[model samples]
Target: MLGVEAQKSPKGKWTMPPFDPRFPNQNQIHNCYQNFLDYHRCVKAMSRCGQSSQLCEYYFRVYRLLCPLSWVQRWNQQIQDGPFAGKI
Candidate 1:
């Protein structure tokens, strides 16, 4: 499950993480969140285009609306700090 730090405060808590240079520089984390967001957005767009709602509801209803979105959000955070720093 996603730890408290990766959560988006859907329940009114503060959503941002305290900055730490040792790890993610925001883009990585933001990209991950956006990836999930994109999937759901496509689902909606598809629905508007006459696709059945049941076709892609899995990502939004079963995943995002549930607790797994936050957990899937931590995919890149499991790496050690600075692993990608100053690479070619």
Candidate 2:
């Protein structure tokens, strides 16, 4: 099952989402952001670069990109409400 409702986005935690289950870190928030970027790149490349996608892949890209944006919106509320406000 999708773990959204049951799992908070680490907004109030000492850590953050996308936390590495392997090696430990006190600041997993940064890592989560990094991973989000990496995955975005992969999705872009796969959908727009080497290969092209049909309607399904297009939908997939939209859904995937929204994940990080959701995280940013949820965790870094100030960032969204600050400089880059209303741009994305």
Candidate 3:
């Protein structure tokens, strides 16, 4: 059962985000943007509540996997420069 177990284990597998019913169409742009916002929102909320930010990593990983590197870079820069237009 080693092969079966390996398949079940997520150790070495890379994958796209699972299909989100909220963004059912072929285009994943909205999904990617939403995940990025969610990550920041989650981190912000966690900090406000005195919770650990580590719990927000799920959205971080999802956005990083789904968004283009260039877009991510631009967003990070916008955030750092205090001009990010996103709600998060």
Which candidate number has the best TM-score? 3
* Winning candidate number (lDDT): 3
Which pairs in model 1 have colliding backbones? none
Could you tell which candidate, 1 or 2, scores higher by lDDT?
A: 1
- Cα TM-score per model: 0.31, 0.34, 0.79
Better candidate number, 1 or 3, judged by lDDT = 3
* lDDT scores in order: 0.43, 0.42, 0.76
State candidate 2's TM-score: 0.34
**lDDT for residue 13 in candidate 2, whole number 0-100:** 33
Per-residue C-alpha lDDT of model 3 across residues 1-88, encoded as one tens digit per residue: 0133321323343487766799999888999999989988888898899998778777766776778878977887888889899987
Clashes of each: 0, 0, 0
Candidate 3: which pairs clash?
none
In candidate 2, which residue ranges exceed 4 Å CA deviation? 1-23, 50-71, 74-88
| Ten residues in sequence with the least summed lDDT for candidate 3 | 1-10
